[model samples]
Target chain A: MSSERSARSRHRAILVLTGLGLAAAAILATLDHFTHEPIALERERRALAALTAVLPADSFDNELVTDFIEIGIDGLAMPARIYRARLAGQPVAAVYDVTTDRGYSGSIRLLAAIDPDATLIAVRVLEHRETPGLGDRIEVERSNWIRQFSGRSLDDPPRQRWAPDRRDGDFDTLSNATITAGAVIEAVRRNLEHFEVLGESVWSDPEDTEHD
Target chain B: MKPEHQDIWRQGLWQANPGLVQLLGLCPLLAVSTSTINGLALGLATIAVLVCSNAAVSVLRGQLRPEIRIPAFVIIIATTVTVVDLTLQAWFHDLSRALGIFVPLIVTNCTILARAEAFASRQPLVPAIHDGLAQGTGFAAVLIVLGASRELFGHGTLLADADRLFGPAAADWTIQLLPESWEMLLAILPPGAFIALGLLVALRQWLIGQTGALRARAGQSEAAA
Candidate 1:
């Protein structure tokens, strides 16, 4: 009789524990349901804001996300996503999300936006693992070094001039972080050249080709 | 203050500080304390999570079986952190972005779990709340002091980018301690954090020793008089 009673108590303990866990899960799920929408909306708002900052404002009327295209190009580690902006049903600007592993530490992800004439609208570092207080100057929040890329076209500086100052390039490299600065300059130049070669095909269709 | 109140402050603020004494939750402390605004933002977030989690744990203490208490506490803390994290993302997007992974990393902070298990799980609702406030304040105080010292030396500025944490009105809150060209790169790096923390620990030890000696001298003087 005592053994049966002990078994019954153990069963009760398990039941209580399970019940409490379920209650906690239910409460959290409800809270998550309420908060998830706002968080998602905020993210969307920020993404649109970033798009406007890099691409010219008032140039594109249609939604950017709905016009997204994904293409895997040879010589690139990962497939790139391009957000094509259209004005009156014609493609105006393309923002390429490119990640280059040539940075001194980890990958440097950036949005290189190109205009219809193949001129660079802006090159903004979306994310980077470079050393802070040094290479981080690539970030628009940290410094205006990134602003120099705006309104620059492929033919203006010439292809060779895109190298870092250390490599006799026209662009100035970040102090004490030459490798990081060089990598960014190279990646931006390469991605811009890719956009030029691919032209409007980047938005119309996906293609994979090895271009150096 | 009443003895109970005093006990809470003494334990949370001085005797068992989460940053200096208890040495709990130092990852965010050393990382985000690079600037006063960052520290304050993270500190407030932590306090919010701590208070909410503590209160929840206390309310559910009776029903939580000992064998399953740890998991229950973690679930409660994670839920609280997620709520805080999502709230920040929704309302304070810029600060949320600046804080990045640290905001989510708060769930892993041992201090919150320790309090939930040790104090909140055994105590009533009121004391649990009080303990949370006290501990949070202690942690924030250290973060602010460290942040101030680091920012002053690192960037030669105080409350720089205050607007990032506050709002548009605080745009001019940045104070230039050094010329615009001067920047101590070391002070902004991880090594600076280690050095600053070491100095803070040394200062605390020195202060304790001096106070002890002063009290001894006072007793001798009283006896002689």
Candidate 2:
């Protein structure tokens, strides 16, 4: 009788603890839902700011959010979401949200903007897991290495010169982060090439088809 | 409030410090101490979670069965950390981004669990709160010192990117004490964190030894007299 009573009490204790855990989780979930909206707004604001930084001020007039296309391309880890900018109803540039798994640690997300002439406008490292003092030099905030890709197209530096100078190319790698620099250079060059291959198709009108 | 509570505070803050003495939660300590603002942001988040968890644990102490107490404490700590993580992401998006994986990883920080078990589970509500604050402050102090040391040595700047912790008004708060070309890569890496923390621990031990010897000598002189 005593043993049975103790077992029953233990079970009751476990059940009570589980109930409390669920209650706590539920409360947190409610709070998270309430807070998620503001976070989403901040993220959108940041994305818009990043887009504006890569493109010139006078280039686009329409909303880039509404004028976008999504497609999966080779070499990229996931489906690339390309935002299009239009000046007077004509396509001015295409911005591709491409991610590469070639980073030193994990994936490095990039936003590559290409002009109507298929030349590269600018490439920004949106997010990365590279070492801070070493590979993180890819960030414009960290170093100007990323800014060098602004004016250069696929042919200006020539296809062969896309690799880092240490690899017998024009671009230079960071002091202690050759692998990361090489990976970024390749990701950017591949993105530019991808844009050139697709041309106008990269910026298909949103109202045209159900690519979803 | 009470003499007992004061002892608890002293133990948490100094004698058995969560950071320097106990050496709990070193993952975030070493990883995020690259910048002062980063460390401060993480430290504040931790304090918020620790306080809430300790309070919750103390309240539920009577009801929790010993057999399942560990899991219960973990659940409480994890919930608190998640709430903190969400709050930071919502209100301070930039700091949230800067902290990266370290915020959610706070759930794994043993200091919260240890405090919940060793102090809160057996203490009254007021004392639990006191312990949480003291321990959190200790952890935060160590984080800030390590962060400042690393930043000053690594980038040769103090409070670089202070705006991340403060706001837009603090954008120019960065003071560059070294030339642009000056940078010590080792100081920003994992090795530097270990070395700095080791030195701090050694200094603390040496100070404690000196104070103990002084007291012993004073007691001997009085006895002789």
TM-score of chain B of each: 0.91, 0.91
Kindly list the per-residue Cα lDDT of model 2 for residues A1-212, writing each as its tens digit.
99999999898898978888788979888998899899899989988888888997778999986677777767888678889898988888898888999999899998998888988899899999998778999999989999888888888799889988889888987878888888888988887887777766666665664543
**Model 1 agreement with the true structure over B48-103: per-residue lDDT tens digits:** 99999999999989878787788778878987898888788878888898888999
Least lDDT summed over 10 consecutive residues: which range in candidate 1 chain B?
A: B216-225
Q: Residue by residue across A67-168, what tens digits does model 1's lDDT show?
A: 777765444447877788889888888887788888887888888888878888898887787776788889998888888888887776898999777889
Candidate 2 recovers a fraction of native contacts equal to: 0.68
What are the Cα lDDT values of the candidates?
0.82, 0.86
Q: Which tens-of-lDDT digit does each residue in B150-199 have in candidate 2? A: 99889888888888889999999988888867789889999999999999
> Could you give the CAPRI-style class of model 2?
medium
What DockQ values do the models have?
A: 0.54, 0.71
Give DockQ: model 1. 0.54
Once fitted onto the true fold, the runs of candidate 1 whose alpha carbons sit more than 4 angstroms away are A1-9, A74-77, A203-212, B1-3, B213-225
Worst 10 residues of 2 chain B by lDDT: B216-225
